[model samples]
Target chain A: MTTNSISIGIVTYRTSLEYLKRCLRSISFQSALDSVGSVVIRDNDNGFDREIIEQAIAASGLDKSLVKVVEGDNIGFGAAQNELMKLSFEKGESAHLCLNPDAALHPNSIENVLEFASSKKFLGIFEMEQFPVPHPKIVDPYTFETPWCSGCSLLIPSGVYEATKGFDESFWLYCEDVDLSWRVKAEGMHCYLVKNAQVAHFVHSRSNDSKEDQLRALPLISAAKHLADKWGSPRFSKDMAKEYERRSGISIDSDSLNNVPRPSPSSLLKAQPDFSHMLVFSPSTWIEE
Target chain B: MRPNITVVTRTQPGRESFLETALFSLSSQLLVPEEVLVVAHVVSSGPFVELENLIGAYKTQFNSIQLLTHSFEGDGRTVSLNMGLEKATGKYLAFLDDDDVFYEHHFSSLVQALEKNDNAWAFSNVVRAGYGPDGNGYSLRERSQPFKRSGYSFLDHLYENFIPIHSFILDRDKCPSEARFNENLVRHEDYEFLLRLASKFPPYYLDETTAEYRIRLDGSNSVLDGSSGMTSEEFMLKREIWVKSNYILDQVRKEIVGWWAPELREVTEKLGRVADYLSTTDLTKRMEEQKKAQAMVDEIWSSTSWRITAPIRIAGSIAKRSPIPKKPKVHSLKDGHEVVNEIKSSFAWKITAPLRRVKDAKLKKQP
Candidate 1:
């Protein structure tokens, strides 16, 4: 077995420089970052200059030379993450940590998660619990097995990423992680929460910026429709399509459902996506919302 | 006045790491603060040195991050806050405790709200999060909006403090003298400070949860925290602190907000009775709490109802049944140093402290 050297992928939109700097600072403080892992910032802004991105990285506390900053057109989130991880794989990193720009990891987060992941016979996807606000999803207290993993602070082993082929790019923003997690499980791999690790991720839930909210909400609704269609749940798909039209004020035909991609027949037989519970899609939740 | 914010962050020795996170939070704010003041209430120079080194490492991110070391003999939070308040040079003042955090937009949105309104201070909504031990480090257990943010009333605030310290920003020009925190209260220092500030300037509530209030249940830092890992001795010490807090609050309550609603005092006294049910306390400690309570009352009285409102005081004096003393010693936060030069020497003031407390209590008894 190879030593699991980690590579981090931070998919950034027009993220706050302060958030990015603090995020970088958090990762740096977690021990010797340079030796154990590499940090990559894959920018998905419409037209952010490379210089501006470099300056932002420097301003954020990272010596820009140490970080690999990629800049170009808005490639969408799922695609950017996939691209970064693939690049990391080529560089021989055993695992990829999909970190959000807004996340601040606890100093022992990486070390704890790595230790836990290595203890298992077959490595799977390990998710770091969000601090200050833990997601209202279930993760077994003792075993650390979760129904699905949120990509906000997820760790994917090289094998799992190669098998699942990363997040479905059809999902521009949300629900992509759920699809990928389900696929990982269907492939007979495990998914879990690294019980001891925490990453401080704030969902700016109460910020009254309707403009940004609208931009964020539309993609989320669109992603829901795509996810539902991919999972072969007609009811959820139809409902999400209707919701998309109502919320986005755009009329779309049933064309979106047909364009949805699918896995091989054998993989579909293994994949079982549950939509029984509305909003939060899981059987057991540790904390109430 | 220019709209630069001076963020005051008070931390003790153990919370140095948390303090680093807090400074990073400040660094990421959309509205950059003009200054950052970190008050370390360490009894020994060793912890203070560690804090100094830590702050020095992060000094590149902040042009002006000053560390003020305080050797507070008692409950240190309020005194630490007062120390920050004294040195704050920015036009507007904000506070972020070491353990708590602010989102990037926390300051920008607050300052924007303050700019739009005539109110001296504006507060954003803050969500409370509970964290516990997970072996490697503390992990968040749950989160809740424990405080009601709508329809803020200063009268209602007297009953309970719903606002977190980091949630609000005050314009120094508007409430200069009223800015000091009551050093007496061990637990609810932020609440006590808000009461005094809110009494004068009705804060503009921004109605957004831009900051977070974190509490650790596994015997960690923060108020109303730590019972699981606390040993019997630790529990008893914690119990005594709470008792002193209750006793001190009761003392200040009588001389401060107790005038308008005497019934409220009765309710608090009832709560005090409930605390008394727990254990028999030390009389010497009670006397110490009483003295601290008098100091708190003095701080509240010092948060003067504007000296400009003399005519109203004269008119309202007859209706209240008693007139104030001929001389009311008013101290602004900035002029805190000149009190000795103005009147009684430090020696005379120390000796007559009991006599002064009695007189102030009588004056405060009038609504």
Candidate 2:
């Protein structure tokens, strides 16, 4: 296969089956499927819904040899993507696409991104065309340059993936993409927004049930604390904690954040890129339709 | 001992008849106030002259009446109230809108409730009278009976403004000066003031209706008049903005120090964990650190001492790159045979044997 060939990676936990089916159907019709080297799926639920996923794939009528399913314990979103990336790299794939189970790509998304990515010298972090409202990453419409992009749908060159060591495993859910993007920039690489490459991410609706609310709160708080400490601002963490407490009537225990590993000052001293200046486009700039 | 009470009433230019009626209601109170301080605003000297003449007529009937007038420019009820409060020498304080009236037992009922409770203020239920949608006057259209037995719940008060301004009485000494009306707010000043009071000292509730809230549908006297050309959505949106801008939620959250406080604190702790985990401020600080480090490196390189160590640094670099002897790999014959046998016996080799033979034959034919 040529160096421009792409591999798609999807990590599934207890995701909705209907959403997964639609995601697979979108992938089956992609124009770049002919150039797709492999499709690897890591089931974080240890083959809990493997049958249903396999049935969806079979119904899509894509070549069975093109897909590979690996069952394992729930390592988390970032870690599972890392596993898929490793598998794709071992298969000699040049680029890796990290996809959320609930996201579906537009037909020409993969093809368009690859075409644009081939011309760039550094590893390109392609942005997703989020449906309904675009992810609030300011992007230069003409140049496709952005400060940061969501990992819901990202196209990462293998070279860049290896250089940044994938995402920081510290983040189990939210803000992992931001950490990865910053690290990529620190390595003197630019992340881009592919204006035409659209991926409709079906955001998971938050459960109103109080138990589920508590369950969801834990990871988000953990991630926020890790980011604040790693980046060096206790104020951001305190403000966010205060806002959450005001909205939810819950006091945040800041003392628990002491356990999170902080980035050494020496490591921080290596790169001093201004995050605000990373965006090439003004806040008002956005994609039409 | 009877607590001396000062009833401060603010009236607009054209509300002389309503102000007279309000003063009459105070005169009929079972426990009369020590003084009825009327802060009336007039646009021109004509209205002020007319109000002085009207008060002159009431002075013969009630000797405790006092009138203070100002040139009216805008809604300055909060400013007038603060001025009235400064002149108030009574042990207890009460407020009366010129358009609203109190029942005969309003002062007595509130004082009794405040005396029984340790709270700074006390409020009674209020009956609302207004012009109905049909243009006909509706007397006692609604009563604030629900709040009569509400006791003192700061949480409930956060979500609503149940205590009408005129229905409440404050113990002047117990009430903090900061608990006065917030002059900054153009609307819902009463609710904002009550929220501030509730945050520090939750007001006691008397299970009695001792006041009437007169809602002039003509939109002249009432600030919360629904007839002010605002759509229901607009009204609600404005109300929400007022509540948020006044930090009502923040005040209520701060006062959540009772039974539910621990639960809230637990929730806050969990949320704090989430905030800490998701914060990107550390990344911002790292960028700063990086700049400082770069500056230090630049400084060190430009120093004369660094120039003197150039030859030593070059020798160190050469020493760092010096080649080391490679270690020889030792392989056992038994281990090599075992690896070859395992690969040959693997399922993948067995399954692809036919395809491998066909590919080999095809390649031979092509040559």
Candidate 3:
């Protein structure tokens, strides 16, 4: 296997098949496909879309043996990514990329992100900038270090993935990447962003369904509770508890939050988790007060 | 059978790039419109070959696609819109600008809304996106809801346009012949038509944002000369639109809601009390009157006659250490005819006016 090669992992749950086909088509057109050693897709909808995805892969111009689809039983995004990453890492690929199913890569996106990450061994996680709606999290121009990298097009070396022990599956849905990045930061590693790399991700559908919103809110608020408990931020914890109760009508006691996993006290001190802002932790120029 | 939905897209001759996205959005619709009429504004030079070629590529996606060329004497979007509507054979009609996009469920949701209701038209919520050029096609700067309404109100419609033109789908049979766009209107022709149509048949409102109104900050869009962000050209265009809107508003005969008179009668009675409270409580006038009374007493005390009468005042005074009392009361400020003013100025004066101001402000915001 190539030393600097990447093993791309994509997780899909009730994703548009058209969007999936488009995503694979974009990857097949990559200028640096030589750097991609393996590709694994985890279908979190119990292999419902596996046949369609397989057909898409067959047409995608990627090697039939190199790309494989695995069935998943609706496991959460972070957990699904972890499973896919493990499979690819076992294949001896040097780097891991957790790409969103909705995202389509630019021709040079993989080449640019890999080049940027190659020069920096201390990089815990690096990601391509999303096009049309780039993440507004601030990046230091001099250092190219952001508060955290988005899991939308996350790229990290397999060694860093092992050192971080991958994402804490307790996160289940959102903010797992943030927890991972903070943990990486605690170990004195930087999470960098590549502006030259661009991925097209436009799946922000505004659903008027209150039930669907509530379903989304549960995982989000649960993750928030975990983040607040682990980071020792009373404000974020209190706010999430209040919101979770308001939305779900289920009160979460302080005792329940203690069950959430926490970093060591020294790791907590080093990570310096900022619960000041909602999504992006450190002070960022991109987001205005 | 025809799909019964006609998407009347109004575009300029040179807008092939933006028109592609607009067409792509329509093509991607869950309930795709079978009929698409692309009405382009053209000069005497005839058809836009590039636009025709672009439409040719998407002909297989749509059921029946027609590229219509319209040449009008005056400058306005009404010409293209009117031609599209006239040529439209669908029972339902909709308008899509070259720059905007419909969500997958946009057509399906609004169609459902219209199907359920007896309304002449139905509108779904539309979000506005601020777009700037990235290395890729375009980067969305931000999304904001500049126009969000709970429901449709004909009275509120008379005041200002809260609905974007593309957010709505209108029924052809339910609409009267008089509900045509006012060609005299250089802008807000849709608003003018909506005013007339809504007066006759109140529309239904779908509470889902099914379309995106893109304001290209890259200056590609004429609506916003979005160079270096949302520029002065946007404000300038709005200024021009409002000025034109004034003319459009005057052209239509607005109905005076006759049923609200009974409620207005109660409002008038409350206003009378507010007027009665305001007339008596002239604050500066009362302060002046008090000052004048104090000065008169001071004048009398400083006079030689007052000095001569000091002995009588001292004899009359219970505490006669000084010729003058500590404070003089103003009797002249008391108006016997006005009972409202009889209440002492300190407590009633402060609380009453503020309450009335709140009352009047509430009344002003009623519409």
Candidate 4:
């Protein structure tokens, strides 16, 4: 296993075959093709798309030996990704790319991220470029200091992943990314946004629906309460519950969250990053073109 | 039954014309008062004679005109008000400054509002007439578009005195007898009294411009009189004193309520701590300190020392990276291909070979 080799991990559940094929095709066409030594797909349900994924892999024209699919019961997103990372580490891979099922990478995304990772000594998490509008995890353009980066297409080096122990599995669904990012930063490791390594994420289309999706808020509110309990001020949790109740017109059962573990006092007392210089507005180029 | 209303007007000497206007407005009220108790501060015999003569002339038009004289002293209004409050015999009480006048329906509107809402007190909007910047003549002050009228918020009331004293009409029975003007407060006595009154019952708002607050140009001893010679620091100190006093009185109100509940007492203690913290740290001083610290940071960032140590800082960052752990020896590409070749040759793969062969058949069928 070479230091520059990358292992790609994808977690799929009821994902469209065409989108999966496009994702595989994009990876096959990456600029540094030989650097991607392994591709692991962990299916979080019964292998319904096993044949389809095999057909897509055959169509992608990559090394058939490098591709492997493992099936399991519906654990969760973070849990499934953890399984893939464990597999990648056992394979002696130096870097792991946690790619979302609904996203397709740009042609040079892998090459660009690997280049940047090598220059930085491959110690921090590097988020890939998001198309259309960038993720709202604002960073100072000059300092490269960000509050947190999204988990949609994060590239984690083997060393940092092993050190931070990946995502906290307690967060079943949402805010797991924030928890991971904060934990990584707490260890004095930095995270950066790799602007040139782009991924075209299709999740934005899911948000454009006109109707209010109240059901989706249940897990989100639960995750937020869990986060606030662990590492945030109690007032913040109370305010979040109140605001969600007001906006969604559905009361959250906060009594259920009593069992969540509180964060260590040291983590709670960590100094917050200064966001006074954050640029909240979109640049003119985002709107013009 | 119609309640008797007492019009308590506290006057000082030499404002005869303004007093007459106030009195005339009262005399023309559709709902007349039981008596106009004129608490006059007469420092000399001449002013007393003038006031007595003036009341005597209006005694015919009014049902009763009583003139109670007091010696001129510091903060004569609060002192005379407490004295006049004793002489008031009406079921309802309303105050009027000698320099301000009420509209014809001022007392009637307030009475109706208080009666309709079953409120202990009612207050209306005022048309603030003051000299323009040139000090030439009086004109209506240009109020903000959304004028904040009287409301029933104790927190808002604590921050500001939105209800003018003249605009209020109190139900004498509902007002606690102990709730009187704080003679110590030369400046916000009326505001302080209203705060105490509001703690018991929020004033009902009669949203009508039914009174005129006269602002004199000659720097008279009125609440609206601007401080003439006070420096900014002196003015700020005066404001801080008033704010501190208001906060103390507010805390007292909270403490009285806190006696019933332990939680409330705890909350009040916390609030007191917060207030103490706020008062001890002057915002401007803190801002200046922050500015100085920021300047120091900027100076350091631009200094030659920072520039010279840039490589060392870069080296420090480079040295912080932990060495990557040794990778475990795993199946190489040739070994992986051998496993794939084995799977292709196995019985299960051969059994599933027919299923996998459907792609060519499906393509042939499509053509």
Candidate 5:
């Protein structure tokens, strides 16, 4: 066990067991992870491709004692993270890592993140260099700046997670990490990019045959939610709305397409609106998955 | 499960090379389409002789290439897609533009996703790939990740339609047998069809990069400079349709939020606290006061400020005052790229630069 105690939380949707096995093996092999007593797999109950993942775990022959699986109905991403956060509080641990099922941690990624959390004066947000995918820069969500860590592999310090209130359940998918990082920054805490840490992320397909079109709409809805949350929806402005939809991978109805109103007077006065040129509907209009 | 696949292609004469590439990509690397049907308009231009030549090459490679060339009774592309659908035989249908290429993993990925899930309406991210003036190939665009929601419904359709026309794959069993692309809507026809599809099935995403969406200078889906301007007549019609649809959706969404708002007060209060918790400059403080001035608009959204403020939101009418725009805060790294200033620190500069200067100074002293 390392000097600080950290628990890892992995959220699994409809992912393959082979990947999960690879994921567990990678976490188990973390050179500095002895400090981690338990790794919780919060399985979003679509009956996770369980048989294969279990077989893979057995094949890897890692200590089964350190692994625990939690099954539940389809809770949103933020809710799942909150569940892990609640678990951490129950165990009296200080921090929990929200790892994507498709992502694998490097040997010392947890240690590096913890090391930063242990002594850093302010809220520290560090993202790893996503392996196989060459995105070296970390982005700042508040500014839409590049290099913000992809949620695929993020180490959440317990303090920052609690302060930020975990992921926003309103954001069912897409940009939850960006929203979290932004919310963390909103609380006056700083997010960082640890150049040394590396996480292997296997980008998975979000859609299968059963619900193809609905899967396509997820990003569109999330984008609208993001824009509505960040840049109040405007009355239809086709250009800005199209740009928003294209860039965010979100879609909107043709009338409401650019029909969301411009920034409310309150937002204009409180802080500069991030997307003044774009239009959005009320944040309430976003569909929860 | 067998490869339940359908191919939707609208062909014209001169696209011989595009046809060859599409056919080779579809037949060689991906799942063999249970039925490959091509809908071509009888028109003037490239040699039907050459079109036949391309068809022959594809047929040699795959057994199911059926060429159904007809002089369309209508003049729109959407009509052509509707025509193609009438002839499609497979249970799973994927739209392929005449000018696109399918990656090796496209069919396999779609097939796997369909097998894994109970509902099989899936779409994958497409790479905007372009051939340079020099004949070299390069990726022009990239998608960061696949979307989260996966179920087809009308509300999903009403939300947005960013799915590229050629990027979608449909299940034939749940397929709207009479569904037709909106022939009158030239610009957003795909958006309309997707909306109809979403109403019926839960959509899914194949996060894999499965196809290359070619960006051609002519005869393609690229939006040109003047092309962005909407005709006044077309604009008004679109607006009328949108307002009607959004009203219904808005009503439903508002009711859902209303049911939770009383219990969600804590969440709202927390959001308010989070808004107040945002870092403030002297200017930011004044902005906060101004936000409270307008009671009707409970929130403001824009890209300028790094934060989103939750306002004392009211229903129905919008506030008269529009928010001012601000530039996002940015900081530059030593490597010349800039980032937001929140993460900037003098310590980062202090940690990175001194070693180089120290080495240089020591060399001079030794000399």
Candidate 6:
């Protein structure tokens, strides 16, 4: 039998049980997945609905033997990806796909990625449109020619990941993709946006309440540190500093600021809620038909 | 008011005399640092003991001199400064390397400039020195410092950094509380920190010459001869920032939007222009005009008074002393000078030389 070519690693952090099920169902029901490699779900959340998630996995009706679910140490996104890269390297997998939990690839997305990969070697980011509300040309992940592959639907060749030493751990949340793409570019490898491959990223839904708040706040803080690291921190103007604070609300509170690191990976995984709230804003099945 | 300046020094091999002279120059100056903290990185046994002795001798004249030593944390300049910042108890921070000296008016002038303007974090024009066996050479010249353009907005400092960090006095309290010297960065760590700081504070220009930034070819860590390779930490540091700059630029765009919405439109227009330029392989007439317009923008940046004006002032000295052709010769034209006497006598001699010489000879023979 021919070995599987691509292994997909999805980090499901605080993803709703319904969304996870639907996402898994979409992946498992893909007609092109027979030659697909293993699907490894590294859960960064404190806990998840095992019965519901497992049942959804079973209902997708793909080969159950091809699945691997690993519990992570709650070590943020970059660290988790690094772990995936290590595991894939050991297994001799040819390529790795990093997918967000809320995103679902179209039926031909994987096939197209593979076909395009055969012609040109690259780390691919799929052309993404928001789910339920598609802008067809909304520029969120990149404003210009996509500089780096987005983590939402990134496809990485095994060689590129190893040579660049994976993503940096210092970047806890935001800019990890930016960091990775630059590293890939530095190695003389190109980062491509596979316009042919389509994936729907269900970004910023009301169901992901707590996670969204954390995501919004953390990205701003990381962004300021990123600026500080790139430009000289000592010369930041009052306007510049105020602008960073205005966007993120992370202030220079001497009372709150500590030289200490955040406590060891708090897995504040609350019970996954019913994502029926999304249906309120989302179109009905009849409407879709 | 006295500006509390902190001088950070790390002892290297065979540089004790230079360090002592640097310290003595500070001590002799009427306006010295409020407290000079010498944070020495004691690597080997060579000249560290002498540094200790020098610090011990000046314990009384100085304002609470503290000599702290760390057993070399793998040659990271950013890490060293971060460590110094943690221990520093100063209102304003000024960095001076061990090999450099400050003129007598350095501290007073910098402090005066800072006092005059409250909105400004201080920076000064530097005099680059070339010291050798004959003391400060002809290369000892005063010039305006180059400030970073990344901090500027339409009229304000947007995010441009033009001054070298070592050449400025930064307000400690007003500085971004979360800012750090990317201990990971070996090369552009200072640049990185300054960019962050510039994002938060408006830097003031001090046009006066304050300190001598020494460039001795004989120093232990001379830019030309320093052979220390990148540490594993430094390599990891660059890897960290290379990944971070783009991520930060994304944030930078967002932050820019928050303060000045107009700048975002301008930046987007610039990006559009770049994108349009990228599409055309050969420059069309329209594209050529756009290129010329871009060149004018560049010329405006280079010709700005506060920006590259220092080089304009130095061009005269550079031209005269320059080994290149086409420099006009300059000579002293004083009335009592030898050249003047030679010029005056040459015309008189040509007018009456032979007759006067023959008459004098005839008179002498008769006598």
Per-candidate DockQ versus the true complex? 0.17, 0.01, 0.16, 0.01, 0.02, 0.00
For each candidate in turn, the interface RMSD (Å) is 4.5, 30.4, 6.4, 32.6, 13.8, 35.0
Which predicted model would earn the best TM-score? 1
Error of 5 at B215 (Å): 26
What value does the lDDT take at residue B336 in candidate 6?
A: 20
Q: After TM-score superposition, what is the CA distance of residue A143 in candidate 6 from its true location, in Å?
A: 16
Runs with alpha carbons beyond 4 Å of true place in candidate 2: A1-3, A204-218, A246-289, B1-367
The ten-residue window of minimal lDDT in model 3 chain B covers: B337-346
Give the per-residue lDDT digits (tens) of candidate 2, residues A59-153. Answer: 55568898889999988788889889888888888888998877766666788888778767536587666642355445554576676667888
Q: Which residue pairs in candidate 1 collide?
A: A18-B28
Give the distance in Å from residue B21's predicted Cα in candidate 3 to where it truly belongs. Answer: 6.3
**Model 1: CA > 4 A from native:** A1-7, A12-30, A36-51, A68-73, A102-122, A195-200, A208-215, A249-272, A283-289, B1-74, B86-92, B97-99, B115-119, B131-142, B177-179, B216-367
User: Runs in model 4 with CA error above 4 Å?
Assistant: A1-3, A206-208, A212-218, A243-250, A255-261, A269-289, B1-367
Query: What lDDT would each prediction earn against the true structure?
Result: 0.72, 0.65, 0.73, 0.65, 0.56, 0.54
Worst 10 residues of 1 chain A by lDDT: A280-289
Cα TM-score per model: 0.68, 0.40, 0.60, 0.41, 0.38, 0.35
Cα lDDT tens digits, model 4, A97-157, are 9987666676667888888877778867888866423564445454454566677888888
What is the Cα-based lDDT of residue A13 in candidate 3? 82
For model 6, how does the per-residue alpha-carbon lDDT over B1-367 read when each residue is reduced to its tens digit? Answer: 4437766654453566566656655554435576776766666654566777777766644676776666655665556677677777777777666766665455666777777777446766555443222122211212213332223343233333345555677677777666677665555556556655665676676655556566532333353123234475764665566566545543553564475645765775566446545655565754565555545434433433313334543574577785432212222111122232232223222233335446644763582
Q: Candidate 3: which pairs clash?
A: A132-B140, B217-B226
Per-residue accuracy of model 1 over A1-289 as CA lDDT, tens digit each: 2356888898888886666777877776664354446788887875454555566666656555567877766777788999989999999988899999888776667877887888874367999977645676666566888878899889888888888789877777888888888889889877898855778776656665786777677777777677777777779877877877876788655545565567666766666677766546675333433
Give the per-residue Cα lDDT of candidate 3 at B179: 58
Point out the higher-scoring one by TM-score: 3 or 6: 3
Pick out the ten consecutive residues of candidate 2 chain B with the lowest summed lDDT.
B134-143
Candidates 1 and 3: which is better by TM-score?
1
Minimum summed lDDT over a 10-residue window in model 4 chain A is located at: A280-289
Candidate 6 residues A77-160, lDDT tens each? Answer: 878877887787678888888877666665556777766665664443333322222322212223222444566777777887
**Clashes per prediction?**
1, 29, 2, 0, 86, 41
What does each candidate score in C-alpha RMSD?
16.3, 32.5, 16.6, 34.3, 22.8, 33.2
